[model samples]
Target: MAQITVVQITCGQCGHKFVLNTSTWPSTIQCPYCQEEMSQDMIPRVKEAWGTASDLNMDFARYHADRNETKFSVDLIAEQVHFPHE
Candidate 1:
Protein backbone atom coordinates (compact mmCIF):
# COMPACT_ATOMS: atom_id res chain seq x y z
CA MET A 1 0.00 0.00 0.00
CA ALA A 2 1.24 3.50 -0.77
CA GLN A 3 2.09 5.67 2.22
CA ILE A 4 -0.23 8.63 2.53
CA THR A 5 0.67 12.08 3.85
CA VAL A 6 -2.09 14.07 5.61
CA VAL A 7 -2.12 17.83 5.96
CA GLN A 8 -4.44 20.47 7.43
CA ILE A 9 -5.07 23.66 5.49
CA THR A 10 -6.93 26.90 6.08
CA CYS A 11 -8.93 28.61 3.35
CA GLY A 12 -7.47 32.07 2.80
CA GLN A 13 -10.77 33.69 1.95
CA CYS A 14 -13.19 32.06 4.39
CA GLY A 15 -10.94 30.83 7.19
CA HIS A 16 -12.33 27.35 6.76
CA LYS A 17 -10.04 24.58 7.95
CA PHE A 18 -9.83 21.17 6.36
CA VAL A 19 -7.55 18.20 5.77
CA LEU A 20 -6.03 17.09 2.50
CA ASN A 21 -4.64 13.89 1.09
CA THR A 22 -1.27 14.77 -0.36
CA SER A 23 -1.59 12.08 -2.98
CA THR A 24 -4.45 14.08 -4.47
CA TRP A 25 -3.11 17.56 -3.79
CA PRO A 26 -4.22 19.63 -6.73
CA SER A 27 -3.31 23.08 -8.05
CA THR A 28 -6.66 24.42 -6.91
CA ILE A 29 -9.65 23.37 -4.82
CA GLN A 30 -13.14 24.70 -4.27
CA CYS A 31 -13.83 25.69 -0.70
CA PRO A 32 -16.31 23.29 0.84
CA TYR A 33 -18.01 25.93 2.98
CA CYS A 34 -18.01 29.21 1.11
CA GLN A 35 -18.07 27.72 -2.39
CA GLU A 36 -15.10 29.85 -3.30
CA GLU A 37 -12.22 28.61 -5.41
CA MET A 38 -8.85 28.62 -3.67
CA SER A 39 -5.37 28.20 -4.95
CA GLN A 40 -3.37 25.50 -3.23
CA ASP A 41 -0.30 27.74 -3.15
CA MET A 42 -2.11 30.61 -1.44
CA ILE A 43 -3.70 28.58 1.34
CA PRO A 44 -2.09 28.28 4.75
CA ARG A 45 -1.17 24.85 6.00
CA VAL A 46 -1.70 24.82 9.74
CA LYS A 47 -0.78 21.26 10.60
CA GLU A 48 1.08 18.24 9.34
CA ALA A 49 0.09 14.75 10.43
CA TRP A 50 0.75 11.14 9.53
CA GLY A 51 -1.59 8.22 9.03
CA THR A 52 -1.33 4.68 7.70
CA ALA A 53 -3.26 3.11 4.84
CA SER A 54 -5.60 1.47 7.30
CA ASP A 55 -6.29 4.80 8.93
CA LEU A 56 -7.35 6.41 5.66
CA ASN A 57 -9.87 3.64 4.90
CA MET A 58 -10.12 4.76 1.27
CA ASP A 59 -8.70 3.86 -2.10
CA PHE A 60 -5.98 6.14 -3.46
CA ALA A 61 -6.26 4.65 -6.93
CA ARG A 62 -9.66 6.27 -7.44
CA TYR A 63 -8.10 9.72 -7.26
CA HIS A 64 -5.60 8.99 -10.01
CA ALA A 65 -7.94 9.50 -12.93
CA ASP A 66 -5.60 10.90 -15.62
CA ARG A 67 -2.77 8.40 -14.98
CA ASN A 68 -0.29 11.08 -16.04
CA GLU A 69 0.80 13.52 -13.34
CA THR A 70 0.23 12.83 -9.64
CA LYS A 71 -3.24 13.45 -8.20
CA PHE A 72 -4.52 15.05 -5.01
CA SER A 73 -7.69 14.72 -2.90
CA VAL A 74 -9.35 16.73 -0.21
CA ASP A 75 -10.44 15.06 3.03
CA LEU A 76 -12.59 17.30 5.11
CA ILE A 77 -13.14 16.55 8.79
CA ALA A 78 -15.54 17.88 11.44
CA GLU A 79 -13.09 18.11 14.31
CA GLN A 80 -11.35 21.43 14.59
CA VAL A 81 -7.64 21.94 15.34
CA HIS A 82 -5.62 25.05 15.89
CA PHE A 83 -1.97 25.73 15.11
CA PRO A 84 0.18 28.83 15.25
CA HIS A 85 0.31 30.56 11.92
CA GLU A 86 3.66 30.42 10.16
Candidate 2:
Protein backbone atom coordinates (compact mmCIF):
# COMPACT_ATOMS: atom_id res chain seq x y z
CA MET A 1 0.00 0.00 0.00
CA ALA A 2 1.19 3.50 -0.77
CA GLN A 3 1.45 5.97 2.06
CA ILE A 4 0.84 9.66 1.53
CA THR A 5 1.63 12.77 3.49
CA VAL A 6 -1.20 15.22 3.79
CA VAL A 7 -0.40 18.81 4.58
CA GLN A 8 -2.95 20.90 6.42
CA ILE A 9 -2.84 24.48 5.22
CA THR A 10 -4.94 27.53 5.80
CA CYS A 11 -6.09 29.88 3.10
CA GLY A 12 -4.72 33.35 3.50
CA GLN A 13 -7.68 34.97 1.88
CA CYS A 14 -10.58 33.22 3.56
CA GLY A 15 -8.86 31.64 6.51
CA HIS A 16 -10.24 28.34 5.33
CA LYS A 17 -8.25 25.20 5.92
CA PHE A 18 -7.78 22.32 3.51
CA VAL A 19 -5.65 19.23 3.01
CA LEU A 20 -3.35 18.69 0.10
CA ASN A 21 -1.90 15.28 -0.78
CA THR A 22 1.05 15.42 -3.06
CA SER A 23 4.54 14.04 -3.46
CA THR A 24 5.84 17.45 -4.44
CA TRP A 25 5.07 20.35 -2.19
CA PRO A 26 3.73 23.29 -4.04
CA SER A 27 4.96 26.83 -3.51
CA THR A 28 1.43 28.16 -3.90
CA ILE A 29 -2.09 26.86 -3.64
CA GLN A 30 -5.52 27.88 -4.80
CA CYS A 31 -8.01 28.21 -2.00
CA PRO A 32 -10.93 25.85 -2.49
CA TYR A 33 -13.17 28.09 -0.40
CA CYS A 34 -12.80 31.60 -1.76
CA GLN A 35 -10.87 30.61 -4.85
CA GLU A 36 -8.25 33.08 -3.82
CA GLU A 37 -4.58 32.64 -4.56
CA MET A 38 -2.26 32.09 -1.65
CA SER A 39 1.39 31.37 -1.21
CA GLN A 40 2.60 28.45 0.83
CA ASP A 41 4.95 30.78 2.64
CA MET A 42 2.10 32.98 3.77
CA ILE A 43 -0.18 30.29 5.15
CA PRO A 44 0.85 28.36 8.22
CA ARG A 45 0.81 24.57 8.18
CA VAL A 46 -1.22 23.18 11.06
CA LYS A 47 0.25 19.68 10.82
CA GLU A 48 1.73 16.97 8.69
CA ALA A 49 -0.22 13.73 8.86
CA TRP A 50 -0.46 10.30 7.30
CA GLY A 51 -2.90 9.22 4.64
CA THR A 52 -3.82 5.72 3.61
CA ALA A 53 -3.80 4.25 0.12
CA SER A 54 -7.57 4.47 0.08
CA ASP A 55 -7.35 8.18 0.82
CA LEU A 56 -4.82 8.63 -1.91
CA ASN A 57 -6.99 6.64 -4.26
CA MET A 58 -9.90 8.94 -3.46
CA ASP A 59 -7.78 11.99 -4.07
CA PHE A 60 -6.51 10.54 -7.31
CA ALA A 61 -10.03 9.91 -8.43
CA ARG A 62 -11.08 13.43 -7.50
CA TYR A 63 -8.28 15.07 -9.42
CA HIS A 64 -7.38 12.40 -11.93
CA ALA A 65 -8.65 14.42 -14.84
CA ASP A 66 -6.32 17.28 -13.96
CA ARG A 67 -3.33 15.10 -13.20
CA ASN A 68 -1.68 15.91 -16.46
CA GLU A 69 -2.19 19.61 -16.03
CA THR A 70 -1.01 19.55 -12.44
CA LYS A 71 1.90 17.22 -13.18
CA PHE A 72 1.11 15.20 -10.08
CA SER A 73 1.72 11.48 -9.87
CA VAL A 74 0.98 8.79 -7.32
CA ASP A 75 3.16 5.80 -6.62
CA LEU A 76 1.32 2.85 -5.17
CA ILE A 77 4.56 1.51 -3.76
CA ALA A 78 5.57 4.67 -1.95
CA GLU A 79 6.76 3.94 1.58
CA GLN A 80 7.35 7.37 3.04
CA VAL A 81 4.08 8.26 4.73
CA HIS A 82 2.96 11.78 5.55
CA PHE A 83 -0.30 13.13 6.89
CA PRO A 84 -4.06 13.35 6.36
CA HIS A 85 -7.09 15.37 7.55
CA GLU A 86 -9.16 12.82 9.38
Candidate 3:
Protein backbone atom coordinates (compact mmCIF):
# COMPACT_ATOMS: atom_id res chain seq x y z
CA MET A 1 0.00 0.00 0.00
CA ALA A 2 2.71 2.45 1.00
CA GLN A 3 5.80 1.24 -0.82
CA ILE A 4 7.30 -1.77 -2.62
CA THR A 5 10.21 -3.84 -1.36
CA VAL A 6 12.14 -6.22 -3.62
CA VAL A 7 15.02 -8.68 -3.25
CA GLN A 8 17.95 -8.08 -5.64
CA ILE A 9 20.37 -10.74 -4.63
CA THR A 10 20.35 -14.18 -6.28
CA CYS A 11 22.68 -17.09 -6.84
CA GLY A 12 24.71 -16.49 -9.94
CA GLN A 13 25.79 -20.05 -10.71
CA CYS A 14 22.82 -22.12 -9.63
CA GLY A 15 20.21 -19.34 -10.05
CA HIS A 16 18.86 -20.20 -6.65
CA LYS A 17 17.43 -18.13 -3.78
CA PHE A 18 17.44 -14.37 -3.47
CA VAL A 19 18.07 -11.68 -0.85
CA LEU A 20 16.40 -8.43 -1.67
CA ASN A 21 16.89 -4.92 -0.46
CA THR A 22 14.02 -2.96 1.02
CA SER A 23 14.90 0.52 -0.28
CA THR A 24 17.00 -0.06 -3.38
CA TRP A 25 17.79 -2.35 -6.32
CA PRO A 26 21.39 -3.19 -6.98
CA SER A 27 23.15 -3.39 -10.35
CA THR A 28 25.31 -6.38 -9.49
CA ILE A 29 24.18 -8.64 -6.70
CA GLN A 30 25.89 -11.71 -5.33
CA CYS A 31 23.82 -14.79 -4.77
CA PRO A 32 23.45 -15.75 -1.13
CA TYR A 33 22.66 -19.35 -1.87
CA CYS A 34 25.39 -20.25 -4.37
CA GLN A 35 27.72 -17.34 -3.61
CA GLU A 36 27.83 -16.48 -7.32
CA GLU A 37 27.88 -12.89 -8.51
CA MET A 38 25.10 -11.52 -10.71
CA SER A 39 25.35 -8.27 -12.55
CA GLN A 40 23.47 -5.95 -14.86
CA ASP A 41 24.73 -7.97 -17.82
CA MET A 42 23.51 -11.25 -16.36
CA ILE A 43 20.02 -10.00 -15.53
CA PRO A 44 17.91 -7.44 -17.32
CA ARG A 45 17.63 -3.96 -15.84
CA VAL A 46 14.39 -2.04 -15.56
CA LYS A 47 14.01 1.72 -15.66
CA GLU A 48 10.49 1.78 -14.25
CA ALA A 49 8.32 -1.09 -13.09
CA TRP A 50 4.61 -1.36 -12.34
CA GLY A 51 5.10 -3.83 -9.52
CA THR A 52 6.32 -7.28 -10.66
CA ALA A 53 5.88 -6.45 -14.33
CA SER A 54 9.03 -5.40 -16.16
CA ASP A 55 9.75 -3.86 -19.61
CA LEU A 56 6.90 -1.40 -19.16
CA ASN A 57 8.39 1.33 -21.34
CA MET A 58 10.10 -0.97 -23.81
CA ASP A 59 7.24 -0.84 -26.32
CA PHE A 60 5.56 2.44 -25.52
CA ALA A 61 4.67 3.40 -29.08
CA ARG A 62 3.08 0.11 -30.15
CA TYR A 63 1.30 -0.29 -26.86
CA HIS A 64 0.06 3.29 -26.80
CA ALA A 65 -1.26 3.09 -30.37
CA ASP A 66 -3.16 -0.10 -29.64
CA ARG A 67 -3.96 0.71 -26.05
CA ASN A 68 -7.68 0.25 -26.52
CA GLU A 69 -7.49 -3.26 -27.90
CA THR A 70 -4.78 -4.27 -25.43
CA LYS A 71 -6.85 -3.11 -22.48
CA PHE A 72 -9.60 -5.67 -23.02
CA SER A 73 -7.45 -8.80 -22.94
CA VAL A 74 -5.05 -7.27 -20.44
CA ASP A 75 -7.83 -6.56 -18.00
CA LEU A 76 -9.39 -9.97 -18.49
CA ILE A 77 -6.10 -11.82 -18.07
CA ALA A 78 -5.04 -9.65 -15.18
CA GLU A 79 -8.06 -10.49 -13.09
CA GLN A 80 -7.46 -12.18 -9.74
CA VAL A 81 -10.03 -14.34 -7.99
CA HIS A 82 -9.63 -14.88 -4.29
CA PHE A 83 -12.79 -16.49 -2.96
CA PRO A 84 -11.55 -17.23 0.55
CA HIS A 85 -9.44 -14.06 0.56
CA GLU A 86 -6.24 -15.91 1.35
TM-scores for all candidates: the values are 0.34, 0.34, 0.35
Query: How would you encode candidate 1's per-residue C-alpha lDDT over 22-65 as one tens digit per residue?
Result: 66556666767887876565544322323443244334444454
In every candidate, how many clashes are there? Answer: 4, 8, 3
Would you list the clashing residue pairs of candidate 1?
24-71, 24-72, 24-73, 25-72
Q: lDDT for model 3, please.
A: 0.44
Off by over 4 Å in 1: 1-4, 40-86
Question: Clashing residue pairs in candidate 2, if any?
Answer: 5-82, 5-83, 6-83, 49-82, 49-83, 49-84, 50-82, 50-83
Q: Model 3, 1-86: lDDT tens per residue?
A: 22233433334378565545634556666666766765566444432332333233334434656773352111102233788858
| Alpha-carbon local distance difference test for all models | 0.54, 0.56, 0.44
Judging by lDDT, tell me the better candidate of 1 and 3. Answer: 1
Where does candidate 3 stray beyond 4 Å? 1-12, 42-86
Tens-digit lDDT track of model 2 for 1-86 = 45344566566578777876466555666778998876566434422323454466557755755664342444333244668953
Best by TM-score: 3
Is 2 or 3 the stronger prediction by TM-score?
A: 3
Candidate 2 lDDT (Cα, whole model)? 0.56
Window of ten residues with lowest summed lDDT in model 2: 42-51
